[model samples]
Target chain A: MSDSTPSTPRGSADPFVPAELYTQVQQFYARQMGLLDDGFPDAWADTFTEDAVFQEASRLDEPLRGRDAIRDSSRARKKRLEAEEIDFRHWLGMLDVRPQADGSLHARSYALAMRTRRGGELDIFASVVCHDRLVSVEGAWQVAERDLHHDGSGRD
Target chain B: MSDSTPSTPRGSADPFVPAELYTQVQQFYARQMGLLDDGFPDAWADTFTEDAVFQEASRLDEPLRGRDAIRDSSRARKKRLEAEEIDFRHWLGMLDVRPQADGSLHARSYALAMRTRRGGELDIFASVVCHDRLVSVEGAWQVAERDLHHDGSGRD
Candidate 1:
């Protein structure tokens, strides 16, 4: 399922992607989101590479760099959402995956964050496009860089 | 590269996506956007399958179903944008692609709509996630269904 072999450049004549590799990448994202929505920020943070870069929509002034910073932000976000009694679900869909020459995968997807308040009033809190650069580390897919572009000026 | 061969069911042990096929799929969406941004609404609408379904953010109550409706709406949108002298660019990224058992592909990506007014002052107008279902016909990939979920209650 994992391709450890050296990859050709983006324009190479042969750019085959195995079905298993695609599925594995998809599953990796699913797990990351599941952990975040299910109140496991630490686990979700672990999905990123050690030197991961995350650019969130709300915080444009400072990008979260490295795994420790990402984990801290995730933890803070989880606490804030919980304290506000907001039940949030992050739905990721419409993914396009492209394998790069450096044995990494460049993936993009749409993200919809829906929130339910105390009275069960559900609303879409955030909509953004997530651009990710992913790398395979020890047979696992980890996010190396993620740039989130928000649809509007609002919190996700 | 286009693969006319029959696709195996999802979760199959063998799911092979040729490099050329992947490139073709990416190009299809790119062409679609190019046409729209270049003020060719009719051509952009033609990128969809005959019976395509499109659910936009502003008109949630009315989902554009079929090619005719899609074309009409696109034309109208283009006219409105042009009349207002709005320079809009739809940036799509983070695409995740999955092959379905029914020989179709499910793709999702993030979209950010940026607008510049007559004064050249740019702003992020809308952020949304686009979920798409695509199929290949005559060696060309066409969008079968698209659902745009906006981040907030704002126009994109």
Candidate 2:
């Protein structure tokens, strides 16, 4: 909330972005993941651009192209988890943010999917490295591409 | 490493600190926790002020006082974990940063300790919310006090 305006000049392309931009990117992920965990699949998908591509290299044969495709997959996953009485919290950390030459941002982070079953135990559902291409749309950050690399899958 | 310089004027503590200060606080925790996880207990302890106090409300009857005490405890724990061939990775997220009237920073974050046994399984060792009072010492951030609230303990 501390002034999300782009303070850096266009085409700066710094190895690391400004601290304000870094904090903003973290907040953006927090909101996006919170939306997904709260069962708002459409809202979560809306954080992505219309033609965003999401790929899990370890499992997916091809990327899920487009926001609609992402939304459908998220909804189906949420429904299955709900039926199984499982709750998931996606935690992100160790973020690396850098400015791109085209006024976009490159973000990479470690993603942990912590799963808990109602009246049951808590466990790790997935551990992956997320690489994202972020662009601004209407002054809000949106994911244009996301590639996930699962741990120990030799995908990297 | 965007300038760690305090840009905000003194005695102007808002509900939240500036975004640059927020990101710097995150970086501080990243380095502090990384040192502990990387088997540098003494180095990790050095991140705290000499008179720092650390307390776990749910478990510790009395808080650990002084950097020496913290270092001793951390070294002992590290030895035990190494003997058992266990590796831990501390992941922190959802950080809340606010400025204090005393020019210090109040930072709170969700900390996840993920444990992995050599050639064995990976699991969550602990989940806690860490509340810290961070002070700048010689232009470097250090923990002055830390209070940990473990999940399901209801100490909060």
Summarize candidate 2's per-residue lDDT along A47-140 as a digit string, tens digits: 9999999999867998999999999999998999999998999988878676778999888777887889999998875666688999999999
Pick by DockQ: which candidate is best?
A: 2
Candidate models: Cα lDDT each:
0.73, 0.80
In every candidate, what fraction of the native interface contacts is reproduced?
Answer: 0.00, 0.18
Deviation in Å, model 1, residue B59 alpha carbon = 3.4
Q: Please name the candidate that would achieve the greatest TM-score relative to the true structure.
A: 2
lDDT of 1 by residue, A1-156 (tens): 136546754444645467566656655665567567656666678788999999876657888899999888877887787677665667777777788889999888898876655444456677889999999787667899999988876534
Stretches > 4 Å off in candidate 1 = A1-43, A49-76, A79-138, A143-156, B1-21, B153-156
Compute the lDDT of residue B21 as modeled in candidate 2. Answer: 77
Candidate 2: Cα lDDT at A136: 99
Model 2 misplaced regions, further than 4 Å: A1-19, B1-18, B28-88, B93-111, B115-120, B126-156
Candidate 2 residue B95 Cα shift, in angstroms, is 6.3
